[model samples]
Target: MDKLKINIAGLELKNPVMTASGTFGYGKEFSDFMDLSKIGGIFVKGTTLHERQGNPYPRMAETPSGMLNAVGLQNKGVDYFVSNIYPEIKDLDTNVIVNVSGSTIEDYAECAERLVGLDKIPAIELNISCPNVKEGGMAFGTCANSAANVVKAVRKVYPKTLIVKLSPNVTDITQIAKAVEGEGADCLSLINTLLGMAIDINKRKPILSTVTGGLSGACVKPVALRMVWQTYNAVNIPIIGMGGISCWEDAIEFILAGSSAIQIGTYNFIDPAISVKVAEGIKEYLDKHNISHVKDLIGQLSV
Candidate 1:
């Protein structure tokens, strides 16, 4: 099979398929279904400075082709992850990137500082696009200036690969992409679930308790591809593209659109091993087309 390896920041990945944050809990949960080390990397869940219980009971809602989640960044916090969880998973064969979700700028900075001295963590994914919280959640990513400030604050303390996760809920994603690139962001992950909702007409109530939630799955493929392609043109940093990627064709589209790598989100719920399958499928396509390195196809699309 053809090699499908790529680099994010300076770290090498076996293949370019990874699970998005929040969808895959720490690597432990997925190990039940398939080997934890099969995919390129496991992004794990979104962790903060404190443990979050998540939203109310109705934290998730199902749309026609996607799912909405208001699971408010529920995890055991940074200290616990470093102290308890890190020791257990440090020996895993794949790259372990800790995804950080914060409600304020200080929260993002503190999380980055705590992770910098920890040798086990190879990188940190700044989750600037969570729509559930009221304060500094998606607010930071929606505006270019705020997004740049968050990246700047984290850059001061963290010296490793810093991946800024972008939100799709904006007018011009290129504007925000340029803003973060100017402030020392090492890489970017795009189209983190579009804003959407579902309703129970008979019950006269909203599907999710939060009234609105972030939509992810097969339905969002086109929109996400467009955003990734646009951001790829706006910045030079490597982009980890995601949103509605479920098959090999979808994976090819993301690469042709100029993504250095791709992340699988809602597909994990349907098939726990989707990322692994995608990794193999990409290799097959590359071999059939006589393509060597996967990076050879990035941004090779015709307008």
Candidate 2:
């Protein structure tokens, strides 16, 4: 993993491959398939100030090359994590990052502040761009001012690596990236599922109970790559690229575009070992291309 070492903002990753929040659950679930320590990082499921019931049934639907989810940030709350989950995962070898979400500015800040006491948990990924919830999910992400406000509030409490994940639903993603950057975000993660809807033709109604859900998987790669590239040029901070990355080549395309790291999301459903395979595949790519380090590939794309 020598050549695979990457420093996204201040977090040192063994490699640039990690499981996206929600898709991977806690690091414990995948232990049967792969070593948790081998993962670059684990972005745990979304945690709120209190336990959430999440969205209603029919929250998931399959599409042509992707999947839509209206999971609605379902979790057992931040307190539950600090009390129960933290003790279990604290010993894992990889970086444990909390994906923090809330309904108000205070909710996000308070949740982050609580994790502050956990030494094992080094950072928090602010889920300001979650598209599934109605109250505070995508609301804080669509506008620059709202996005900036969320970051600013959380920045006050979260002392460690502060990564603000962005949404692709905006008219201009780079603007949102720049706004968060101005608010002192250490790193940025792009293109959290795009907002889309599916229909149940048989019933002539929306497939998702919520009418619309966040679209992810292979279908979103192109849009995600474009946004990562645009945001990379727009801001000076590090970027973690996600969306439609099911293979090593897809991961390389993102590094070439400007991603310092990449997250494996929906693809985990297809192959639980996909993250490990992709990690090894990246090393093989470096050896073949004679590239000394993975960081060399970041923003290496030439016009």
The candidate that wins on lDDT is 2
Cα RMSD (Å) between model 1 and the true structure?
1.7
Model 1 TM-score, 2 decimals: 0.96
lDDT of 2 at 164: 92
Give the clashing residue pairs of candidate 2, or none.
Answer: none
lDDT of 1 by residue, 1-303 (tens): 327767789877888889898888788788888876777888878889888888886989888899888887878899999899988888878888999888878888998799888786789999887432545345789989889988999999999999999999899999999999999999999888888888999999998898988899999989999999999998999999999999878888999998989999999999998888898889888889988888898889999
Error of 2 at 281 (Å): 0.6
Question: How much is 88 displaced in model 2, in angstroms?
Answer: 0.8
